[model samples]
Target: MSNGVIVRRGRYYWHLSVQALYDGKTACIDWRSLLPLNGGTTKQRQSLLASSKGLLIALVESPRDHRGERLAHSTVLNWVHDLRRLIRWMTSKDVWSFSDLRVTDIVDYMTFSTMRKDGGGEVAPHTLYMRGKLLHEMWEVRHQYPSPLLIDSTHWILKRRDDGDAVRRGGHLTSQLLFPCSVPR
Candidate 1:
């Protein structure tokens, strides 16, 4: 609405300055109380901004048949909601910087997000990989931060490892040989 959800720079909480339609008049929804996951330190705040930018880009380029019209807007808004929840969890632990975020933090969040009542919580390895890839995409586009992973393979394996499955599978489908060679004329 208001220039696509204003998350102010250098702020701790995830602020959404929304324009609401009430009684034919415009109003605002203030979510200032929602603090960021690490007190919103400089680095953390920057990371949030970077992630948001990346998500918007993905939404804009999404396939038309996938989500119907207005998919971009809807997808971006959905991402905002997901980010809000992540922020809430981070704030609870007083984490405020990218440096403060450890592999454990990511694992914990993944668990919290995908946990089933039976305690066999799991997020598909592909989904986990995509999430990290999205973040890396954001970082690359924003050009503010360096590579998220110090070593490329570490990042790849971390994203791919799920439920202790030792085999790494590729998501892409390869083309099979369909044409046969003609020898006789």
Candidate 2:
């Protein structure tokens, strides 16, 4: 498993395509052009999943944000947590690799996370929504949208359900604080 993009050589496809370094020069070859010479067979399906190293590796390796400045530790930690949770859940389902994950798995996780903390009660909508958002962020490499590490391109378009995400807990909740005179004292 690699971390760049899909590369198909003849008929085999590679999920990650490393850059080339030769003659003291690194050529920017199209990742798709640099595919596996073996024409990916069942033996290579295991390789279909992105490397098991986890998104943390890609995050740490990215190091900088869009501005080329270092990302905050908290941001990094959030990414790590998301990746850890996803990996743990995936492993439990016998999915040992990231690419092995199907869109259904994510849908299932999202549905499960929204379940009530108790038996029949629901957590705050924000809690549920945020988890989906955070999980979505883990797919990226170098802050790229839709991530470079997916086996199914359709997953890039996947979105969480919008029903529970109302504007409940933002600053607007303090309408009175913004206008003290409006208080019905």
lDDT of 1 by residue, 24-131 (tens): 432222234334434556766666555444444443444445454433333445555555555676666775433355555655554565543367765554544444
Task: Itemize residue pairs with steric clashes in candidate 2.
Answer: 12-40
Choose the strongest candidate by lDDT. Answer: 1
Give candidate 1 regions above 4 Å deviation: 1-71, 116-185
Give the clash total for candidate 1: 5
lDDT against true structure, model 1: 0.43
The lDDT per prediction is: 0.43, 0.43
Worst 10 residues of 2 by lDDT: 171-180
Candidate 2: RMSD over Cα atoms? 15.3
TM-score between candidate 2 and the true structure: 0.43
Alpha-carbon RMSD, candidate 1: 13.1
Model 2, residue 160: C-alpha shift (Å): 8.1
